[model samples]
Target: MFRPLELFIGLRYTRAKRRNHFISFISLVSMAGIALGVTALIVVISVMNGFDNELRSRILGMVSHATIEGVRDSVKDWESALAKAEKNPHVLGAAPYIEREAMLQGQRVAGGLVRGILPGEEPKVAEIHNKMKSGKLTDLFPGGFGIVLGRELAYKLGVDVGEQVVVYAPEIRATPVGAVPRLKRFTVVGVFEIGMEEYDSGLAIVHMDDARRLYQTDGPDGIRLKLDDMFRAFTVARELAAELGGLYRVRDWMQGHANFFRAIAMEKRVMFMILSLIVAVAAFNLVSTLVMLVTDKQADIAILRTLGASPGTIMGVFMVQGVVVGVIGIAIGTLLGVVLALNLEAIVKFIETKTGLVFLSPDVYYISDLPSDMQWSDVGLIALLGFVFSLLATLYPAWRAARTEPAAALRYE
Candidate 1:
């Protein structure tokens, strides 16, 4: 159907000056709409992708890739477990930890989780060292009873480094007078800000030995493991669980933060659907543009039909014109979207510097910068959707043009 004659006529119709200025204006508007919709989809999706990555990295910075815990209570043989886990090629590092709930009392009172760690081995599984705001991890000696507080947690308790906070353990002690809560005085040696409110507001770190003493645990509660590739966390957790002979249960980072990540994924999907409507509306606008073009070209259609051009060839001509318009819009939009997404951060920075206004503040948001991560797959899918919608929009107009009565159209001309 798309012979040289049909192709030449179709392209010529696309480029030729139109007698009806309204038709030309509508065509231009339709093309611009498609380009705007495609650009919006690309930029929004890329920004969402960036947020997903940034949040994941921040959460995993404190949470281990995977962990093994004793089914009943403390893992008494955590040293052996750590040694065994390190044998696996996928396991990059391992550390023993004890976790329990406790109340911290300073100028204020707040509840938090107390994590016990061996200062020297802690870096193997977590990023506490780099996150520290004051003092050092080494300050938490076996007998020093030193503690590290999360930035928000410290603020909640109205305490900072070099201050003392009394910790009330869950266990009760039998006093001569009556039962009382077992407690200890701990010196705040350091503070760390994880940026995430969940961790920064509710986690405290201490030496493994101090944790055991406070919690009355025989040993560390579990062994935390960091994998070479975090995406393999679940598989490695299962293998470690099996290697340990089922005496313990293993949990991966995904399981730990399942709800949070799931919410992000759901939001991404919803945004994609919502933005797709814009593209669909822009594409369907082609129908109006093509219908008007067909109306204006009745004389041209009659001339082609009288010259023995098949109906299919006439239909192909209109289809080609419509498609050319759509392709131009999609190409321009795709090029602009990719460039914007790639340099979005720098662009944001420039705007902020020039305006002296902050888009994201560290004090208000965990992430203080606009980020973008453009994936080729997303771009390809968006472009394909635009093309398909545009193609579908042309069918009715092309079919109507093909069915025009040559004699009647000639009479009107």
Candidate 2:
């Protein structure tokens, strides 16, 4: 079998001993740099992706994907709106809701938004049933003032299931008794946890009838729609609003947390750009290493040229050598990244247990655990980009090698 002379020579040069220790040193640094950059990028991106995923699945699970509220009155025949919403191709489930903002006065007083829903109908819209920690959803069905509160909220209020908590809706009522505040007493029937500190600390659920009485709406204040695909929520919301015409107005979860999620996306982009450049700088070190190698092999280049080797072939030989180094670094980095991504949670747990420091604290970061989401597509892109930079780094040094004066360089030998 015939082998390409350039490839054979390039492989030889890549493995050959170097006379200049600095050349070897720079080559080592280049490889290490690429490895570090790739590894760090993978880990950080995975964590960011994990956070993004959590926001969608956990946070969104508790909140409505889109709310179609009656701007004119309490969603005229809310049941009919829910039925039609469920029939929409994009919508998976729909439920009627009556929401109110109130303060829970217990051992410790705190304010939060409370949502009233039917226990049986809620599972179709919100995943509240699944998030329950120590109680059942059915508890909310019992006639008078029964409720389910988020675990963190329960803890903060120093109240448990079966305890009475006073709810005060400041904006809902004003009377001669000094702004009556629509005071109501409710028994905590259950506790739920969704891994989001915000939701767990500031959300509660009650019976729709009770909520209707509090909000004074004709029926449900709005219909919550759950879409098959959450990413298309805004589109579906607009379409629904158009479908319902002047009677209803639609709002998506994206609108509710627009700035927060946008900040996260912007942060990820900036982080990827900064980290990718670290790999570029490392790959650029190939120029110095290859330049030194070309000098050391000057006589060989001259001999090969004298023996009829083309300048392009000479350039290919050096270019291939630089690419080989870069490819090796990329492969190692990719493998390391995959391993880390797969085991990031366990690794962090081990470290935290040993050091006694929390990585993600509910008290600080709104999440109580670490998260990782590895995307193979991101890995492929990182590897491809690293290789391209490494190949580009070869041009100057390879061209220098190709331009060696055959007669003059050979004369020295």
Candidate 3:
């Protein structure tokens, strides 16, 4: 019954008019500060998560999650290697590949790193085939001497489907006339785009048979595999590699993109730590507000003590008041954060269109657009931390209120 009354009294003192207008303004500002800081932090971290997801889908999606290659020049009994890898419980997909760095030149144009891939097996291992923008992955048939070009590489070479591109393998040798490059002519069969600049600018694909012929290999250079859970790709690769003996070696996506992914994770943590200071300051501001309220209500405190109110009860009153302010601000902030996180890309686009300024550019950033992904766990953690700090901030002020002496304060009055 008295709980509602206590609640009313608690809220009432929070907004009660006081001679110290500056202190009231500071309290209001502190609440707003927490709200803004939380919203901004949620939006930023969500966008970072979005970018991380984009990289996985657009970049990693096109690349192998794990690769099992022979430590020697080429993998022998490639069929056996493929079969053994597929038998693993964790392996979702597997494909044999002969990837070599070679220059592709058409007319006077040249592009780099012509990757030789098997059309049938590639689809099972990587999503690059699904991303073909023009023509078909099957167009790179072994019998046809055809190759697929990366979107940007296609643009740079100024070639399209049905055009001829010269592929210069590492067969260049010194001749009596001059330096000669071992080159072959292949028809461009298709163009693929994964929206990642690196792939588009530096990669090309050909039939694995064609690649083997170019490298003068009897079998595939290596085998690429995808796992049921990509997060476990590294562990699975390690176990499989060990099982297959020393002839085969394994490499996972984590090894290839370790530093980059680590940097993104590190940046996320650093940003959270820095932004949290803002929330900490806002939560701690309750101390000042409660202390000021206690000083203002000294006379009333003395009267309440005379009427036999315990020090504990007095402490509870101010403690509840401070907590109420913190709760209201955190609740509001969490709601705002959710809204911003869900539609962050749209908001950034609208702002950029209205102002004709790009906040993120494809040239500088990986993707052309903003991304946002909000985790409910992050919201809960932030709210819980704010509330805890708020409770901690109230102790000193609440104690000060509880320590008010009835006789001494009334005598002064």
Top candidate, metric lDDT:
1
Instruction: Tell me the TM-score of model 2.
Output: 0.92
The weakest ten consecutive residues by lDDT in model 2 span: 170-179
Clashing pairs in 1: none
Give candidate 2 misplaced runs (Cα > 4 Å).
Answer: 19-22, 171-181, 354-358, 361-365
User: Model 2, range 143-261, lDDT digits (tens) per residue?
Assistant: 67888899889999999988989888765466776656577889988999887878899998999988777666679888888888887888898888787667677788888888989
How well does model 1 score by local distance difference test?
0.92
* Residue-wise C-alpha lDDT for candidate 3, range 1-413, written one tens digit per residue: 45643456567777678777876876787687777777777777788788888887786777788988888768878788789889999898898988778877875566578777878888888888788999888888776889898888998888889999988887776789999887788998899988887888788999988888777789887888988998888788878878777677778888888898899899989988888888888888888888988888888789878887888878888888888888887877888999989988888899998999998797787578887878888878877877887789889999999999888778878
Off by over 4 Å in 1: 1-4
TM-scores for all candidates? Answer: 0.94, 0.92, 0.90
Weakest ten-residue segment in model 1 by summed lDDT:
1-10
**Best first by TM-score, ranked:** 1, 2, 3
RMSD to the hidden true structure, all candidates:
2.1, 2.3, 2.8
Q: What is the lDDT of candidate 3?
A: 0.83
